[model samples]
Target: MKIPNNLRLIVNMRFYLTLCSALFLVNCSSKTDHIEMVYGQTGTSLFQLKNKQLAYTVKKEGQMVLDTSLLGVTIDGKNLGSNSKISFLNQDKVTLKYALNGIKKMADYKGNIHSYEITEADGFKWKLEFQLSNDGVAYRYKVPGSGSRTVLGEATTFKLPESTRVWYFERDSDWKLKSHAGEWLSADISEMPTVSKMGPVQGLTLTCELPMGGYALLAEAALYNYSGMRLKAIGNNSFKANFTEGDQGFVVDGTITTPWRCILLADDLNALANNTMVASLNPAPNSELFADTSWIKPGKSVWHWWSGKYVDFREEQDMVDDALALDFEYNMVDDGWEAWEDKWKKIAELCSYAQDKGVGIFVWKHSKEINFPENDYTIMGHFLDSVKQAGAVGVKVDFMNGQDKYIIDFDEALLRKAAERKLMVNFHGCQQSSGEYRTYPNEVTREGIRGLEVNHMQEGPLTASHNAALPFTRYVTGHGDYTPLGFTEPGETSWAHQLGTLIAFYSPFNCIAENTQFLLNNEAIAPALNFIKSVPTVWDETYVLPQSKIGELAAIARKKDDDWYLGILSSGSSKEMTIDLNFLKDGEYSAEILADDIEAQPINLEGLNKEANLRQWNTAIPFKKLTEMVSVEGKVTIQLAANGGAAIRFIRSKVEVK
Candidate 1:
């Protein structure tokens, strides 16, 4: 979609996009035991072969962002690239461009790519490839031999420089965990506490403040047809890849290609938030299967499962009505819908009813019901066909709790089959999808973050620290199905905080998990409800505020059309934030700021605050609202209470000719 001549918004985002479009010259040099590549105006990567071991260093612009890091992967119990004769194969200059309906709308890639072949002592050889782009650099390995083989492990280690601070936590600390969700813990790499040797590190993303300068985020990308790769603290101020499925290793048939280990380098928070490296590394959506992506709609949905209500036909019908009233795009019928007598017919009736009302329905399914130990696309296809017949626009497949090869294959089959049926999907209780949405746009979101559901299961409200952590750590990889709002039970966060997440978090299907009946009846919230209704689930662009810090603050502005929604979140104490309106076009905007009302005492809702009661706080929401005129150069001051939030909608005001 091209921008209108009148709405020239990109001009206002000069500072936010300075680093994104710098023209650079590609340069490369190769020696007997040294290979150096530089992506001019972006970054440089240098590889060294010392004592027959291969190690590499990365730089952002001219400064060193990564110290030398050892690289290798073990195949059939033999070390390759760790201590082997690796010779350069070839190098190439490449360019890529694509568009997305979620996150950043479009991405253009101009970078340098190269490959090297390493010969094992026994004469076995494999190719190691690396690619560099504006946002980051990535490396992967490709095995050559055909037929089945059992690969053991990887020696791929990230040797962090001394004195760099890290924010990471041990994932899967409990061995029996089907877990990928975890909050970040901060410390120096040496002081990094809780290094669980038994657990797998999944997006432990602590934006490491490199000693030399800039920030580097170590992450994995394009995780397909392979058991997932996670990191573990190796205790030498380094992190190494660990496949948690087992030490025996994933059995592979024919030549196997490993996923890319990406090091996302950035100078500031905005660049980090806007980095498209992960999605860029993944393959584009299969154009053959989805010849027309018009059916793929990204918008807000009305969900009541988090409300913990029995969604009978009447109740779901009420919810659909609520969706219509709220101008929501979807209405979801969660788990246990199949238990209904004559389930398919009843569901189909409900779907028909919803369709007539101009609303779509989403149904849930257990993975085991459709995916057997043996690959069964036919069963999955049948289920998908039934849902499409029943009027479901999407499917929420629940309990997809592993990252093994079986899980990988099952997901691939389901996505292809679901797309063929024109039904979208969300993998509930699933591990981190690692940007699979780029490959299958119908895979809108997955449950990997310790979000709203877990937020409800715990004692008291979900901590603001946990809420603040997402944008930097978890969200950088891909969207998580947080189901981020609940008014009837605001938990510990303010009503405004619940509202802010709709913009701060990036999920194509922003399924708000709240009882809409309450929001409708409460006249107190009507003033600020328009923002909720107008916020888009996907954004054209996003700019993270300089005030933002992981686990401390989350302030961001997202653009769609001519409007920009700025969401502010603060952890721990109250804060006063002054947002520079430099990102706005040169025009007056009716800025609606929704903030916490400290003076509005809880009218009999204190008990719900102490112990979350899913029903009461709906009517007792005490939120404050203000509207004023502002412009491109103006600044807006927002006062947030302890563990509170604020949201502002910048709607361009029409200027009349006098």
Candidate 2:
């Protein structure tokens, strides 16, 4: 039920007074003010807000187990609940309501907001706010001040039950290069703090399976102006916040509000797959700046970087022509575009050509140049203006490399400035998304994943298992610029599996990372290419199929308008599965199936020595067919090859007027 603002304030005041009285009555006891707020529609989750710490738990069959176990942040070399005298000042409760624009899955979000004000022994005031919803719970800390304060570190801890199993990756300094492609290890929570080859840090997202048959995902939201937080297991099933290295921890000025620490709760893996709580914790988009987002289109782009080609003006023009031929939206002019003497003029000409063909252009720029310290604001403005004059639609800024306060601020400033110039932005070599795209609609996509681009590096190739794991991990946080749908160097996975990624991965500015000529010549997968060309980058709704497994298979169904797209991927081995279409609407729908051909000869990757030539492989294995009958109760069975997959598009049939 919605309450009026005035009535909400009055009720909050009364609740505060009642809590104060209760604290006074129990002042002599060790247990401080024992305040509890029940969340979730079915009373499945409970939050206990104490004077100094917050604890969360999930209930199963009338019995609740500690899902979060314990959570609180230490500040300025002092832990909140340890050796510190803390007193509650006041508390307030309200409802947070908002709608999403130009994104995925759900249209709106509503949650309960609970906030508390407290003072520590040293007179430092802390405001802790918690947002509780049916799907998840999140909390953040705010320290209001006039000048900068030195933060020694944080005590954000996640303690789970003894029998919990964790799925996580070890972190390293070269995280940008290794992104989400790290091999996930399953182990007991007590065996954590698993040291990586580089050091002793854990990845951003940690998925834990509770003893009570539920799951919880530990991650952060709205990460800005602070060093990124990672988990470090301190033994005894406890993980604490370990900030990115800095000389004096994290320095914060003005009113410092830390990022939202989130624990997403789910009954099953499918619920975890469809969770949108991370996006709910972020701020809404600034509509005043980008009121009309009609021109900000999200579609496939042709990239030359992945093909190992030095794209001169002629090569760039060829890519533009290929984009037009393939019905793609943009042609990317990568790294070396700025080296020519008349680079700007040449780029302007190419952009004009692409514009004439109804295709957009995206230009790449070094992050250091754009984030340059000397007169950066003016320099960036002038550069963006020049790009706008050249008729380019977006910019790909690369290699910022750190998540410190300086880099974080620069990222936000860059997005704001890019929005001002009416240009979409794609960030490369950046940190994982914290829903910044929701606030800046023009911020199309960010490469926080170990995408196919890393194929050229010395690191191990991204496997089908890694591809299967992304949708539940990195992609769940926000849009991942995985640069999907690559044909070159198909690495263990079949060509059909590569096609499936075009539908599986979610990127606003999706990159078709293959040579244009090769993609056009592959007649066997022509229909799949057409589907990829027409599929919407953003979706209205999504469903995770029951067949989904962490490193084995990932099958997803997404809806855009009246049409639905289903993508299925398999890892390590071949398997046959029947997919039920009951999630469809009542209307009859025609389906197009694209699957791996059993008759096709497999390319021997061992012979090619990991440096496979694209021209030599018999890459055409996907077989496409359209079904004659239409029914909402239809079931399609598919037999996938090892490291292969399938993509299907369903269109609802319409009745003709008599």
Candidate 3:
């Protein structure tokens, strides 16, 4: 092969050219194969998926119901979906099987995950992930990038079928300070009514009953370092993305994966209550950070704020002693805890006192104290460290008052920083939970509901109707700091109704809004108090009984370890119902029940009128009895008075009673 040098060079060049041509052809073929392949999943073809230019179409019942809803992101002035060429990169389908921890501990989350990876012409990559469960479907977009990226807006749309009836709350500009107020209304999507311009804009979650059998819920999940999402009506049964804007809009560093824009489909209301997709869509806890979550306990805490008293050391110790006697985990020193001279020192002393009694202390601070200018990163970090050094277990940051991108970022920053210092957080006067606790388990609870504290200022009292609706609506999103188990007299609902809230409404850092004197001195509900003390805030499993109605009644059963707790709430009028205990293992069990005393003076019928003075409504009553029964057949019946409720604790019997 030792030919002339020129001839040999020419031969080598030709050989290289031929190899390059073959490699190019193979690459072209690979790209062509990826583009041509139809990536999708089918559950009996009732749900069909297809994508082009990031525009996805979902076919339901053989009809293209959700048509050409484009999913994209806007950065600066450039739109990714509009300006770039899109190509399919890959597709995969798998079953996601996992267990929950924290608020929903011991719950099983199983679903089928379908992931579609695509690339844009400008080199931006996106992974559109969809989870198809028996209950509904949810999808989120993930993008991997470097450096800081300015996110102008998100382009996620939902085009519903015409003639759908929707239920939703209007958003509040002052979302941080007040509970999400206003009533839930049923309206046709095509002719949606306008919300009050003085208050914040529309809320995030929207429920629409499709003309076709099932119902659909539009909500978001895993909101972190991004603006909370709200849907704006774009006419023609179409809604577009309306993000909560921050000071500099929404920006992300390194990577920006938007929260899951979820559409929960349900055949019945009960299915909506049972769906855990919101929590499942979020990433699990960092086991490395919370390896031994034993210290992360969820139980009742005595909050001094509801009493409207500036808690001095003496009052603080009384509450701490009360929590200790009640076997409660924490005693919260709210608002005025820092007003005392040498406040930090006094707090440390109280912490020591409480710690010895096996009770933890939660200190309170304004949200402004942890945000920029007022308290920068260095100051916030030092403050948390100081609190941790003081032996306080958690911090109740309150009065956030906004749902803009800035406030969202601030809320997330507080969680992350508190976690770094090994402290728990309970956000008051803040937006609803977007499954942020799944990422940072240190977030104990958040107050975004119209709770017991509102009794002081609300024109009309919070009703059982509102309470009944919460379990399916607000509570479905995440933990509601409703501040349940109040023993104050002249309460809005019957004593039994308040007791049931301990189980119906979930909050890890559950706050008992009444003073210690009420629980100890009230001879009428002492047995009921004992039941409240024994109830666990976090549950392993939850079941919504078939009798649940959005604005009328809510009956729920939650399990922790071997015991089951049941809570039933009724509105408008007295009622009777039976609960099936079949969810329990096949074994005899002892049930301790506390129900309304029907013999007590009936709630003033005139006061029940919405126009009557709220003070006239009777909220306190004597309990009928603390009855115990052996249940082997797995069924029990109880009666509830008007605006009343019941709570029961079921424990497996050690001896099988014949």
The numbered model that scores best in lDDT is 1
TM-score of candidate 3 against the unseen true structure: 0.84
lDDT at 140 for candidate 2? 82
Question: What digit string (tens of lDDT, one per residue) describes model 1 on residues 1-658?
Answer: 9877656666647644543322111212222334556676455444545455667877777776666777787767767775555566778987778887566788776777887776666677788888987788889989887777777888787877888878664444452235566655567777553444544353434568677666788888888878777666767777877775668888778887988988888877788888878888898878788788888898788887765666687788888899999999899788877888999999999999999999999998899889863455777877888899887899998876777777878888888889988888888766765778888989888877777765465433456777887787778878888888766566567778777888888898888876676566667668777887888888888999888887889998999988889987778787788899998888899999998786777534433333245433333335699999999999999888777898899999877899
- Candidate 1 stretches greater than 4 Å from native: 1-32, 41-51, 169-177, 193-206, 373-376, 603-621, 656-658
Model 1 TM-score relative to the real fold: 0.90
Greater-TM-score candidate between 2 and 3: 2
- Weakest 10 consecutive residues of candidate 1 by summed lDDT: 22-31
Each model's number of backbone clashes?
0, 1, 10
lDDT of 3 by residue, 522-638 (tens): 566577767867888888888888777776888888888888888888887777887877767767777888888888764333322232234665446545655565564667888
lDDT of model 2 at position 558: 85
Candidate 2 residue-wise lDDT, 1-658, digit = tens: 9999999999999999987766753332234334454565323222334443445454433444344555455556666533233333444444444444323544455567766665555666667677777667677888777687666667567778887888775434466323434555567887776545655557678787887777778888888778777777887788887766634677777887889988787877677876778877777778788888887887889888766567788888989889988889999888998997798898899999999999999999987887754665777888899899988999998887767667787888888889888999999878777778777878888887778765555554567887887777777777878887765566667777887787788887888787777677766546666776787887877788887887689898888999888888889777888898987888888888878876766543333223444434434344445564456787888888888888888888987989
lDDT on C-alpha atoms for all candidate structures: 0.75, 0.73, 0.70
What stretches of model 3 exceed 4 Å from their correct place?
A: 1-54, 59-68, 83-86, 93-104, 112-127, 143-147, 170-185, 191-200, 246-248, 373-376, 489-492, 602-614, 618-622, 626-634, 656-658
lDDT of 1: 0.75
Q: State model 2's lDDT.
A: 0.73
**Better-scoring candidate (TM-score), 1 or 3:** 1
